[model samples]
Target: MRSRRVLFAVHDWGLGHATRCLVLIRALVERGDEVTVLMAPSPGLQLLKAELGQQCTFYPYPDIPKPLGRSPPMFYAAMTGALPLIWARFKREHRLTERLVRKHRFERVITDSRLGVWSRTAPSYCIFHSLRQIVPGRSPAIERLVERGQRRLLKPYRKVLIPDFAENGGLSGDLGHDPQLDWGAGRLVYIGPLSGVRRQNVPEDIDYFFSLSGLEPQRSLLEQRVQAALPRLSGRIVVARGRLDAAGDQEQKGNATIYGYLDRHAQAEMLNRARLVFTRSGYTTLMELAELGKRALLVPTPGQSEQEYLAQFHHERGHAWSTTQRRLDIVRDLARAQGTTGIPQHATADSVQRFLDAIS
Candidate 1:
């Protein structure tokens, strides 16, 4: 295979998108591809730089503003009002992509949910899981409209790579698998779970592992709540604050240890050793849980419909126990979660190779 100059664009919504892309990006680098990453100035970008080092070139690119609200209704309203701004950002990025592709002569373009990062001259692909955006009221009409709009946005990409299994309804459930949408034949490919965290043969000595992540006030809110209840919790507890901006300091309390953040390798080691994992019901984290076959207590971010839906989906399936951030009780929720079965184990060893093969 001839070495190809590839341009990868990542959405800076959260660390999940950046972390999941690491698997594919590392594979690209190992295969001798010249990879250039385009992303906004974010902790995710910083993480990628720290992980990839000199393996890939980094370019600072602006992404759409994160229209997060303090509550669910507000969030929906904000998103609806931000449509024009989102469209403008898309146009801006599309223009920038054209210039970048022309200047650098990139042979392939890949975007992780950045709608405007594709080029007409290159074989462009998108990495996305949510094909149908779940509305607050679960209105079929609204959901169908949202699905159609998403499909239109994805039309530029040669393939939309879903990081999930195609069988057993996959890990995403209704979020990725929508029977109503006409996903063009061979256009949407399920490339399995693109989790950077691999299951390791390590002792499950840690009683609990809490990996906190998500956007804005909600993330901070969760942190404050969890910190307040930490003193009441028992057993060997490990908490990753998911604070990418803060220093990676490991603080030890009586029976608990907390860190500002944990990188991929450190996170993987912790996950392997943890008897019970607790995290936000983000798709990326769920994929990691599936990969490691770990049971978890899921608390979805308020106002984020995707996370909320995913939490409920898994909860209903008896795969994991879930609760809202507002009603989370560390002791009670943890006990309930332990009763539920963990995610079914899946083979992700070939997921990256499958992705490469699909693109090739």
Candidate 2:
């Protein structure tokens, strides 16, 4: 195979995008491709730097302002209000992408949910899981409208690679699977779950593994709530705060061991050893849980419709127990989650190869 110069753009909305991209970027490097990552200044970027080291080039780029609100209604309103600004950012991103493509002579451009990071001169592709954005009300009309809009935004890419199985409705369920949407046959590909974490043969010593992550005040809020309830719970607990800036510091509080962050290897080991996993319902996290077949208590972030939908979907299916952040009772939920079945393990060993083959 010829060594190609590839430019990968990642969305800084959360660490999930960066982590999943890391899997593909590593595969590209292993195959002798020169890869460059374009991203905003974020913890996600820091994590990539720490993991990849000198393996790839890193470019700093500005990202659109995150649309966040304290409540679900406010969040939707904020997204609606930020449309113009988001559009401007998209234009800016495209301009930067074009300049980078010309200057670096990139042979391929792949974006992970960054709508504006594609180049006309290169063979561009997009990695996206959500084909239809579910709203707070689950209105069919609203969902269809949003799906149409998303399809239009994805029209410029040569292919939209979905990191999910083609059969059994996949992990994403209705979020990525919609019979109504027309994606121009052969342009949409299901490449299975692109997770960096894998199950390992290790003793299940950790009673509860809290992998806390997300943006801003909500992350802090969840931490505070968990801290308040920690004294009431018993057993060997491990909490990864998901703070990349902490530089991997560890602290001990009673029976629980807390870390500011856990790199890929450490996190994978913890997941394998944990008898019960407690974390968010983000798609990426769900994929990891599915890969490891770990039972979990899911707490969805406030105002995040997608997470809310996913949590409910899993709970109804008896895959994982879920609750809102405001109503979190760690002790009670943990007990309840133990009785439910965990996510089923799926074959993801060839997911990265499938992606590479599709692009090639």
Candidate 3:
């Protein structure tokens, strides 16, 4: 087969979207295909660039505004208010993708939860895990409507690639495969967990690793909390602050070594050395931990029902321990989180090859 030009549009929700996109992006580049990435300026995209180097072309693109608020109700309210902007964003990106497609002659367009970046001339695939949008409260009617809309919006793509198993034994739990959603046949493909971290035989040395990520004021708030508790904590802990824009600086603060950001290899190396990891319960983070077989303390972001549900799911399944950011006491929670089982290795090299085959 001839080498094809591929366009990858990533959603800058968190670093997870870009991190997951790396697996496929690297695969395309390794196969001698021209891969161009369109993403907003964020830590995740920065990490992607550092990882890929000159293998792919990077372009800045517009991103959807995150619905952030102090509480779940407030987040929902903000999201409702931003519906017009969201609509306009979709239209804007749709037009942008059309222009890019015409200029670059992209043979395939793969989007990581970007609903608008698709072209009729090229085969387009959307990478998504959430089929049903979770609201703060239990509102079945609203959830059904949201799910219907999600299905409708994704129908234009050639296929929807889920980073979870089609069977019930998936990492995404009910979000990817619930009984309520009607995902049409052949339109959905389970590509398994897309993670850039590969398990190594390196020895474990670091006692605790704190991976700080997600949107902020919460990100900053969590950093403050962890900083306060760091002096009391007894361990050789390394904290990756998840600040991509900042200088790659490391500082010693009592028993903790804090880094503004870690490149992919460094992050993987730290994960390998860590006996216990502390981070958000994002699906990509879960995949990374699972790949390394490392235990973690999951602190779900407030008001984000998806992360909350995922934390709860893993906690109940003995995969990982979880707590909300408000109730999190670093020293106390570490003891509780240490006793739980970590995520198991479910994804393999075959999964990656299968994903490449399907996309090709």
Candidate 4:
């Protein structure tokens, strides 16, 4: 392990993927391992550059977003449309991975769900959430085909790094995108939750930050719906607009104030101050929420099967309230949200330590 040269390849779909990788990379560096992060240029990537300056080298990976669409069906369609581009990217993935191995003399390749960012000549591992595909049954046969495709794509990796607990799948169910997919025998390792973010000054008295996800029409719809509904509530309200360029000083509209975008520090400030948070039911967001241990109203984007599943999953666990975004009635939603307790505070330390030990 002397003179270890580790390469971390991260997807650029959302800040979550890259952010999660940041935590792991930080751990690797702390252990005196020299690291190189291979990723696409993203806001999160820029943020990491600022945080991990000079500790590691960065190489660009051909990562792309899944595209933003308002509704789940539309977003999926948009993602489907990117199939051609994705395939082309995958082809480039193998080629780049091959060149990096010899050129950089890397000892390890750690990929956070990137298709082709590792090499055949080195010990490359993939970090991902889904082992089994979660198809909506619209095409059962197609789902099987997609599963096979995933298997084929991952076959070349030296190991598969999964972020989950040893049992109970840690944070999610077992059927679709579950632990059952860990068929790589001793080669598979559950690395717990992967998140590099550390929140400061978590407030115990605030309600919520009302985060707007970076996705498309759903983000706009939430803003409009929440603004329209805020007047009926009797409490402090702050909205994080999700887009930095659209950010500004809080604008008062009735009882609510909105900001275009909040930096990590700003977001931590809002999350700490808020009493009842509201956001979409993305798995990565759940990690952050778990860190905060604050109750929330989660409105999953319509038709995104995974989000829907997570909302319901957490709801059933008494961690948050899940409601469909379109059918949202904020008054009733908040009532249910306030009734539910948030996650345990110990969850954060448990999850982070698991990931650290995986690579240890």
Model 2 / residue 245 / CA error / Å: 4.3
> lDDT (0-100) at residue 73 of candidate 3?
80
- State the TM-score for model 2: 0.96
* lDDT for each residue of candidate 3 in 1-360, tens digit (9 for 90 to 100): 789999999998887888788888887888889999999987778878888899999988879888888777887789889999998998899899989999999999999988889998899999889888776575898888888999988988988888887775588887888737777878788878877788778878889999998777788889998989888989799999988766579899887899998877888899989999999998888888878877889998887888999999889988888999999989998989889888877664656786787888
For model 3, what is the error of residue 209's alpha carbon versus the real structure, in angstroms, after optimal superposition? 0.9
lDDT of 2 by residue, 1-360 (tens): 999999999998888888888989999999999999999998789889999999999998988888877777787798889999999999999999999999999999999999999988899999999999878777899889989999999999999999987776678888888646789989989998978887787899999999888777788889998888888889999999988778569989999999998887898899999999999999999888888888999999888888998899889989999999988888999999999889877756688988998889
- TM-score per model over all chains: 0.96, 0.96, 0.94, 0.89
* lDDT against true structure, model 2: 0.89
**Ranked by TM-score, top first:** 1, 2, 3, 4
Ranking by lDDT: 1, 2, 3, 4
Task: Tell me how candidate 3 scores on lDDT.
Answer: 0.85
Give the per-residue lDDT of model 4 (tens digit) for 1-360: 445888888887667786677777887898788898888887768877887999989886557546667666777898889988888888788798888888989888888888777687787788876665566653667666666777778887766677665564456553223432346667666666654445566455555568888466667778888778777887778888788567665677766777878877677677767788898877677777766677889988776777787788778888889888777898898988888988533354565566655655
Q: Write the per-residue lDDT of candidate 1 for residues 54-124, one digit (tens) a residue.
A: 99999998899888899998888999899999999999999999999999999999999999899999999
For all the candidates, what are their Cα RMSDs to the real structure?
Answer: 1.3, 1.5, 1.8, 2.6
Predicted candidate 1, C-alpha RMSD: 1.3
Give the higher-lDDT candidate: 2 or 3: 2
What is the RMSD, in Å, between candidate 3 and the native fold over all Cα? 1.8
Q: Which 10-residue window of candidate 2 scores lowest in summed lDDT?
A: 172-181
Which lDDT value does model 3 have at 188?
A: 80
Q: Which prediction has more favorable TM-score, 1 or 4?
A: 1
